[model samples]
Target: MQNKIESLYKETLKIRLFEENLIKLFSDGKITGTTHTCIGQESNAVGIASLLKKDDCILSNHRCHGHFLAHTNQYVGLLKEILGEEDGVCSGIGGSQHLFYQKIFYSNGILGGNMPMATGLSFANKMKKNNKLVCLFIGDGSFGEGNIYESLNFISVFKLPILIVVEDNGIAQTTETKNTIANKIEKITASFKIETSILNYPDAYDIYTKSKKIINKARKGYAQIIVIKSARIGPHSKGDDTRSIKQLNLIKKKDPLIKIKKKIKSKEKIKKINLDVINEINKIFNFKSQSYSNRKVSLQNKKNLILIDNPLKTFDGKRFGELINHFFHIIAKKNKKILFFGEDIVDPYGGAFKITKNLKNLYKNQVFSTPISESTIVGMSSGLAIEGYRPIVEIMFGDFLSLAFDQILNNLSKFYYMYNQSITLPLIIRTPMGGGRGYGPTHSQSLEKFFYGMHGINIYSLNPFFPLEKIYEEAFQNINPNLIIENKIQYNFILDDLNNSKYKSLNTKNDIKNFITNMSLSNYEDDCRTIICHGGASSAVINFAYDDFIETENSSRIIILSKLNTLNIEEIKKNISDKGPIIITEESYKSFGLGSEIITTLIEDEKFKGRNYMRISSKEGVIPSSKSKEEDFLLSAKTINKKVYNND
Candidate 1:
């Protein structure tokens, strides 16, 4: 007991001193971003962390310095991270607010965001039967967030191995918790039938004893909560302390470090430990290390063309929707690690679009119908992916993706880079996009443009001409996360050889005809203009104006591109004629959309400087519910024809 007390005091002292030094550094303008200090609340983190096994997972909130120190114990790495040094933990991408160590530790700046991710990690633990528990550290402020409630319900329903640690410091940044929160933490969590434990300003030994019981229960596939009534000694962040001197003095009196030191009662030993810790920290800061450089992380070691020669066998005359259903069925059957998560995607409903019909019937354990929480759906998939499971999540409509932007942009897209390429998030988020079905403005939107430039994520569009089986195979095998954008209009289209044929024109003398003939005969055309189109817009352009444009424009040819990001610029340039005009078209709005990106790419090419460039896209406006108005809002055959013939 004496030894444990000494160890706890040492850990607490380490965190307190580290944060104290950081506070001084920030005051002197040494540290850049704002820092959240857990000086008085060290007992909560150090206590619970003591019970965690090496493989157990921890998801922390903004005030995560104590958690990072307690969990990882990498003094130099944590100090360097707070200092924003490149060699720091997370390679300096994650400042004090965002710190990730290996697969077990993760912290984020968003309140209540880590709750769902922690629940997900618990789900993965349960799925893999790893006998590991996931601990989530959230603030009192998170009690007011809907995400925490959603995560709690999900964890309870699934009986995941997770322990939620609510560090109630009585203050949520500037606002006191009593002013913002209505109910007590214990009472609120009890409503969910979750087992709860409350500790009031316990010392390190008290915390360790209480948390070990809860965590042991959690490891047996039970969901639990431990509320630690702690105090914040310093300001919420740098330069933000609003507490009065009296309140500050009261908090300092209850400091865990002081209490533990009193119990140890050895001044010489304590002084010696403090000196050693201080010297170690100083050495890490003074060590002359090489400056940091941003390195590009790649999913593929070598650039290899995606070959589609061996396609999954599909029944004759399958529609696009049926083909999608077939693809999921085959892939899920072949790979047991693939799990499907979405709203209303099980059994009879089979998803909002009926694309996932019959999946749950075959793979009942692997497939699950989620609630309407888009954030948890995506956030949990990130956790599952990190745990070595290929989670294919469906978002129903692409417009709803805005709800999950934080998880997709800040969490999913950055996990690989932030972790210095130590982990891979092999997650596939498949959602139906485009605007032809009259589902109104909110329901029907081609929002792929918003995610165009995100690194570490691949965006794919389903083309009627291509085999769905091959796309699914590639998506399942991809090392990084992929967003498969399926057009609602193309769901019912019949699969045929006509859709797969190369560009053809009724006019025999058209340049597209010459280009196709030359390519077929192993000849090349140097002056052939190229037209690029993707998604439903490609079908619209091909059906309404292909023959007429071919008859009129003798210097232009057309090709369909499905993959949007990580574009094969070299391959596209190989087909284009030298200095020829390049025309790009899309169904999305023109502002900062795919068409704009393509134009920018061409403009940046030194060899394509003299080339004529044009983009045919929808005007910046809402898609009307009426079919005629929607057509007018989108780029159509008439629009393309006018742009080609009249140069409008």
Candidate 2:
């Protein structure tokens, strides 16, 4: 035990020296950008490292250099990463704050952003029965994030194996936690009813003894939290700390490295470790690993299946929602790793729309319906994806997507690039939108516009008039997050029921991604007006055009955009050039949706600028609960005709 403490002291001293050199390097301008060093908190990281197993996962926040150095000992890789060199870990894309190593150490820059994902890694370990636990290192300031509480509840309720380490330095970016956090962090974790421990100014050996028990307890099936009152002897970031000199001196006095050194009797061992750590820092400038660069993402799918098969070739009079629900069974039956997550998504109630009806009963182990924690749902999906699980999350309603938007933007959408392409975020967020149902403002909304600008995610609106091409299969292989928007009223419409003499779904030879690209109804005519929309909107346009309500020809062409973001610009232009007047219709708000984005891009060309076109959408007002008022507030074929001819 004496030798163990001496060994731990050397490790702690090494971490301390490494971070101090990093600070010195920053001052000398050798490292560009910013870095958060764990100068005084070296012992806490070393403690966590001592208990780490080969398969155990460790997630750290911004001040991660110490944890990474103590855990990985890849000082050269870390330094090269900070220098943005090609040979650094993660190919130099993830600098100091963000890192990935051996699929074990994950460090994110966002505050509390990785907690939910940590739960996911724990969930994966538990599901696989690997007996591996996750060590998530967060700050006391992270309690301010609601998802942290959500993650705690998830970890506790599910009993996942995770040792949550709260390295409470008492400050978040210069503001003390007392000023920002109203409740004690321990009390909050205690509320989850999980095992908890708190340590104040503990030395490395003390933390090691306590953490080993904590890690072992958590590995046995219970999730736990350890709040270590560590100190930040250095600035939050270079030159960013606001602590006074007197306060800093007090924090330094409690430094664990100093305490551990006093407890060690052997001076020669300490000198050797210090010399070794310093020598490594000196050689870091000349280190080489792998040429690193940020991963570039393209919306285009690399696999263009020529003979793509569509299982749902023709619906047998089943409603649109029921048909999709059947496909859910098919997808789940095919992939055992495919997981379903949502509120009320299990058997009995199924989903709010019944798309997930009977899924839980069939795959009890895979399907999970939980409390109204949308952020946790997305975050867990991200974590599960990282652990090699294909997760499909339902957002109950598309309007509620805003609740999970931060994780979608930060974790799911950014992790692929942030991790330098070492991992893929293959999760699906399926939800119903539009004002047809009386779900009011909070529930019934066409919120696709909010997801338009978020990169690294695919947006697809299902069209009953067309075949549901292998979207689920592609979603897993596409190496990105997918959002499938469903319309409530459209769910009742039978598949391919809209196909008639006027217009029918077509698979043109111009498809780039499987067959969904040009898989919409088209009548090749350069004279008739080309009305355009997607998903449910296509049925309304076909109904009006086929019934001769406005006496439009059968070949009057309609392009139902299945994939909204990556538009086939050439195909659209080729179909619309010198053709009938362009009429763009969207089921959502009056401005800035699929229709607006398409028309806005097309108008830039001379061929479209002079064309007579009309943009039809839901009028700007509250989507009322009444059926008649809801129809009046949203876009339909009648509304499109009214807007087009009434002004004329």
Candidate 3:
């Protein structure tokens, strides 16, 4: 056991040396991107990871080379990834900061982002009754985020089989631990009433011993937290002052490697250990150098590509309630994995909006009624997705989305990319948005704007004139994690042309192509005023010019942007120049909203010199319930016309 412990310590030391060489590679411009090194904090990562089973899930922070080395021997994948080789873990898309492996929940760049994610993973493991534990390695600094406390509190309440390993390295980058963390981290677990343990660092055997017991307990039926007091010998990053000369000298004195080395008795035994470790390093270095030849590895293929193109073309001219009833009718016949979950959504009563009208009769086990926990709704949906199930989670109203923001931001949005696209989070979080039915501020809102800029999420927010079959197909695509924000106003809306199935005659792919092409060909001039908009009121600007635009010809020339994120630069350049001014209108608030992004981009574009830009958005406040109140505060065609016409 002592010899095995010494071997593990040498493995960790190799990782330290590997990172040091990687830093040199970064300095010499051999590496393209950034990395977070763990030079002194190896003992905690190596010790805890050594106890994990082969199938156990591991989540780690940005400082993850230690985690990668500790979890699996995919060293070639790790090196190729850092070097931006196509054969890399993320196919060179995600760099050193992101090392995702499907076999293990490998890495993340966001601080404290994986806490809730690991919680969701544990939930999935428990639901399957799979006797496996989910482990999360977090830094002392990440514990400062509010989401961490929320995740811990929820994990304890649920008694999920999760092991939270807090790597207490005594510094938040250059800031001392005292400045950031007010209370000791180990004590915080008690406030949540969780089982906790403090481990001695620089002892692989000790960590492995304690972790084995804890892992067994968690796997059976409990949650645990392990706190390890580790050191940060290296800089916070390659060029950081945290690894300065003074710090370097201090690190050498406290080297955990020296401590482990002195314990070994036979000189001949030590020589054999060094040779074995050196051979392992040579294999990794050689494998990484040769990994780029024929790398055609893609974990997720375009599963439903044709289906996304040729959506189901059927929409009965029924009321909104009837259409949703029909929608559920078809969903019941599809597959078992497609599940419906929400507060009021059950078998007979259907859903709060009667959207899930008769799912119980056909697929009784699929439909489930969950507690009124909105966070759990989103979080559990993520877990279900990870377990290879498709979940259509309904939050009763758009306002309730705020309650699930942590789950949405932390797990739902990031799972696919964070795991290097190995996992397909084919989830649809449905909610009724917009205001009119007088449900007050706590029930009605169009909140897709909140998720617009988040790194990993794709927003498919639209105000379809009515129920479009193509929308359902887009929502079910396996490659995309979708947020379908349905407008309450258009819930029961019926398009006359669509009712005749005229859309069915047109090729679904052609329709999208024609729409995008025609939108690009729309008439506009450099001397005219350009207005861009989306969601509910976008059509008003397209078919009918704003009421106040009572006079300007430029009002007719406003180019409507359908794809929210990928704004058409060609169309903008053609229509917006030095002679023209621009205005962006949306139903979301101005701060961190779509309108602000457009205006900022336009003003900064040098080609559009002397162009005046403005954003017509919600008057920085919550969504009001009354039509009259919302109309007074939010941007509508009338308000947009007034703002632009008034400015002109």
Regions of model 3 farther than 4 Å from truth: 27-29, 239-255, 282-289, 292-334, 339-383, 395-421, 438-445, 449-458, 461-469, 491-627, 631-648
Root-mean-square deviation of each candidate, in angstroms?
4.6, 3.3, 6.8
Single out the weakest 10-residue window by summed lDDT for candidate 2.
514-523
Model 2 misses residue 69 by how many Å? 1.7
Compose the digit string of candidate 1's lDDT tens values, residues 453-562: 88878887776655555565566556667888888888887765344443432222212211111121112343355667777876776654445534654444555666
TM-score of 3: 0.73
lDDT of each: 0.77, 0.78, 0.68
Best prediction by TM-score: 2
* Candidate 1 segments whose C-alpha is farther than 4 A from its true place: 262-312, 469-479, 497-529, 549-556, 577-581
Ranking by TM-score: 2, 1, 3
508-597, model 2: which lDDT tens digit per residue? 333435223332234353335677777667666766554533465334456667666556666677655356578777777757676777
